[model samples]
Target chain A: DVKDCIIAYFRRSLQQGGGALSGKRALVTAGPTHEPMDPVRYIANRSSGQQGYAIANALADLGAEVTLISGPTTLRKPAGVAVQDCETALEMQALVAAMPVQDVAVCTAAVADWRPAQIVGQKIKKQSRDDVPAPLELVPNPDILADISAPSPSRPQLVIGFAAETENVEAHARAKRLRKGCDWIVANDVGENSDVMGGRENQITLITEQASEQWPRLDKNDVAQRLAALISERLSGKIDL
Target chain B: DVKDCIIAYFRRSLQQGGGALSGKRALVTAGPTHEPMDPVRYIANRSSGQQGYAIANALADLGAEVTLISGPTTLRKPAGVAVQDCETALEMQALVAAMPVQDVAVCTAAVADWRPAQIVGQKIKKQSRDDVPAPLELVPNPDILADISAPSPSRPQLVIGFAAETENVEAHARAKRLRKGCDWIVANDVGENSDVMGGRENQITLITEQASEQWPRLDKNDVAQRLAALISERLSGKIDL
Candidate 1:
């Protein structure tokens, strides 16, 4: 009778710790990577890192251990979550590779596709109106999403990537999901008229192997909460990836 | 006797309004220009706008009518100063041309020397690792410093430009002062080791037609105050420009 009472007490304590994501681990990437052209100049994007930070907080609220790897952003670090900052795509790639495998991985950083071929040691001088500088030589940066989503023993159970498209949002995202070998892809329109990038609100379509569902425009925090809930259900075997 | 008393009262009020910079109009440019490659991406620099903002505040404290033209930066606007924001170097150029002639103009912004030849309408899609993109094309941007320094009827009485140099600081700054036809050039080292670019402390060399003097490392605010004093001296005919 004493042994039975101890077992019941432990079970109740575990349930009280958290609901669905009690034992889950998550890795999240946010913000925009800067590709250095020189000591002073750089190529960068406009990712605010708000959504990624919100998602990390949401998952942690559900008792998931979340680690956020971010590029340069002014956002404050989320409470109860670990955060690491990186400047370039290559730096982020190395950190991601070194991290331990997790139950879920969310890739939301707008990594630069190309970087200057070489970083000039000195500031390039502008001679005169007659003198024109040569065109900028560029080379492709590493594809982090594809590398992480590749099927391997070390790969996470669920890998999700964000697709910022200016046109043909859903079709491009579906193709990207299959191409990157990720479980799901979140697609959003960032057309000239869409106030999505750096904005507070987001309208997204979550594309999965089963179906694609468009969500209404909502605050970035709400989007993060909704996505985190779905992740918990899927990880708990209540729904498919 | 009554008229003389009224004139004396007016003179006292004028003296109380401010010290050396009283009744002067100044235009200051700060921050780093962003040259857009596309809607989401741009070319930028490491300017924090601290030094320029400090200069604006210092000038205003001495009762100068200050108007600040700035690029993108996270720094808050200084009190008692008019601020106009711009993105690219071209846009800043247009705004500068539109402003009324000022008594003094300080060019401190690290404006981009070049911008993308064309801004892409849509985000450039990253296809695969093998799909290499072409090199980026760049075009020369209008030289605002040289334009403002050239002799003109509406030119400011005093024009000061900032020179960010790594080596031969004095020589480069002197050369810049002569080439741009500016009254003075504030030169600072932004070498790999120097922490002056975005740091609170700064070491500067003031280059003028008469002499070149290097000051010890001090807070950016102190540099602004010292420079403002010199500007007042020059404007009041106490010192040579």
Candidate 2:
């Protein structure tokens, strides 16, 4: 249904000289991954799925067959997109591993870094006022971006990750790209009261291999359009490869 | 009044930390510059003064005499900090130059790279839809990070710049640090979803001469606290010139 809406939009765009994304296959991950502590509790971030939803809409506008692996969110299903729902980081990883090869993969989900060492079948009761601060052991989660970008048989042609920052925006983002082994890292300043998340407008700096282009903050939809256009251009440029 | 507020906060932090940021003077630039297309139609970015404002608050909490040069925003003035307001990049440059020599400087503002070649006194009227787009010529603006990091009487002991990227996050951030002659760069991703802008939470990576540290997504206040702590620690670690 979402895919149909996107295709309808794309057909109209194609009429206006926008090229087709007929053969491209794209994957996107959105929202925050849950690291369950028990049957009733979990660790997660504040991702509302706005970014991922907008990207799916934008990619559909460009004619890409997009599959969105989304965590829990209330965002409307974008037109002309396929969505695979998952609850935990592990579940999301399994879904990614199971998917057929894709041309591009964008990991936008803010995956929890750690999970409880063991899942408790029942919810632990809070006993005394000082319940000894139950020591919850943590284990590291898989790096989805790095996994998708690795030289595997199903490695995506292009991989992108998000580096949201409040303080050291660029330095940290760059290191993340290197550590995660992704092709692109979109950096933003998420300091107090920033409008990028669950907000309507955004200003972004596009850091590519060759240049860093800064665009004025515009409506999120406009940003998506510009990004789609840029990606489409890059994809076309790489056709000979 | 804001200066007093910041100073008071710094005093309290000094009482807690004992010796960190004891004698350091830190300067910060915040907000966006407006490039005049005409008196009525000026170009500006959507910088909400959150990141810089939070930084000011955090720095004050770390026992530093903070000088904050801010662009237009409606945020409450942080207590115990000195602030200068400016509307243009050039004004920001002059203010930064006039400030007392500082131990560290963080250029967090989304400073405009280009300003209108000429600030037209009167607004230009749109002739017709058929008329070719009006060419508003642009002129380069000074690179604040580059200018401050260069050898000069007012050069800071340590300079930091924010690198916001959409692709190749680490490579571009590293290159930017080198190009700008800054000691540190905070690289972050402002992916298509705008996770980092005008949001209350942020995730960041810190890049320095030592190594890169990836911080999980955290509240803006926590980020400010951590960054301030790190800056204070590092400044103390350095040998006095």
Candidate 3:
């Protein structure tokens, strides 16, 4: 159902003049990075990657050469886009570091912040009632957004990060934009509106250095289109990044 | 694709004399129980629920009055079966406990052995580089198999548990069978066979008190059909429990 809906919107956008982002290269990350605890177990999030896929499709429809780095998800590849698959956060970081320079970068993937310190070579046995199980030791994952946003001659013209916050959505996002050094942060409160988390609808606030504009809840495709429009304008020097 | 194959197998089996399991009530658990760390994040396994679904369909085709207690999965409800949805190991345990007396029980869900001791009310904020992350405190989840296997007046005549072993498949499963007091343990070596974990084929060993039968690798549907037939014979007093 989600795939059909995404395809329908993608087709509609392709029919319209989508030359706004022509000649611009874009990199997008979609889905949740599964941090492996062991061979059979992982720490993961509920992100369905629907929003990320929609964004990639929207950008592709707008004529940008897009490469989508995706985590493990059930969704099929978006039409007219190149896709690279990775599972854990560290693997995703390596792929991102190796990508060619782009005009725009959108970090929508909900990368896990921590991973097991060591992957147990074997499946951990379920202990008897008397035995106490071990606690999960974790280490911080590579900061992909910060790495991509650092000052460098090869840095993309515009870098966007997404924040799924439970409280103080705007304040947290505003701080994250500064903290991560990204040009903009798309913030959404998944605390109460779980419909926006893995579901089809999304309500987001576009946070830039100068402005924080909350958009009405809309279909994920519409949100992608609007974000693509802003990205095109920013790249064309019609608007600030 | 998996659904079509399963449905086709179910139909072919239905055309055969499937009355062997008639008038018998069966309970089955399927999928991976997601143990939530927060609203958006969870500890999950790479279970696809395909094998479990196939088993449910096969049992139903054999004229068993089946109730499938399943964890979170993307699969649609199987035809001709009653389904119950659950998210965590504790929830699945509760559902199993509440089911009406069953003639046979199949525990195939890949339930997490431990859950976060305390579920964070808010999403855990991604700390700065200087901050050390806290270890994930975990506590053992309820042993659903042991509980269901405990001697009781209403205990099912036949109880089957599944073990996904990376090493010592037969030995671990034999020990598990005795430790959990289940009648049979279906053990599969997932070490060299990752495809069996989530894909559509399985090679398993059925360990019972009397003998161990090593079944050849086959399509998951066919495995289910064979296991269902074994269950029918056991319930009909032709085979040992």
Deviation from native of the Cα of residue B218 in model 1, angstroms: 1.2
Residue B144 CA error for candidate 2 (Å)? 0.8
lDDT of 2 at B235: 80
- The candidate that achieves the highest DockQ relative to the unseen native structure: 3
- Per-residue lDDT tens digits for candidate 3, residues B1-241, read 6776776466445545456787888898999999999988999998888888889988888878789999989887887688999999999998998888999999999988889998988998886954546888888898898888989988999999999999889999999999999999999888844678888799899999999999998999999999999999999989775
| DockQ per candidate, 2 decimals | 0.56, 0.01, 0.63
Give the poorly placed runs of model 2, Cα more than 4 Å off: A1-241, B1-19, B129-133, B238-241
Clashing pairs in 1: none
2 or 3: which has the higher DockQ?
3
Q: What does the lDDT read for residue A69 in candidate 1?
A: 97
Model 1: which docking level applies?
A: medium
Each model's lDDT comes to 0.88, 0.71, 0.88
Q: What is the TM-score of chain A in candidate 2?
A: 0.88
- Superposed by TM-score, candidate 2 places the C-alpha of residue A12 at a distance from the truth, in angstroms, of 42
lDDT of 2 by residue, A116-167 (tens): 6687754333322223334546666776777898887788777878766655
Query: Which residue runs of candidate 1 sit more than 4 Å off their true CA positions?
Result: A1-16, B1-16
Model 1, A1-111: lDDT tens per residue? Answer: 565456445434443575567777799999999998888899999888988988887887777777899999989777567789999999999999999989999999988
Evaluation by DockQ, superior candidate among 1 and 2: 1
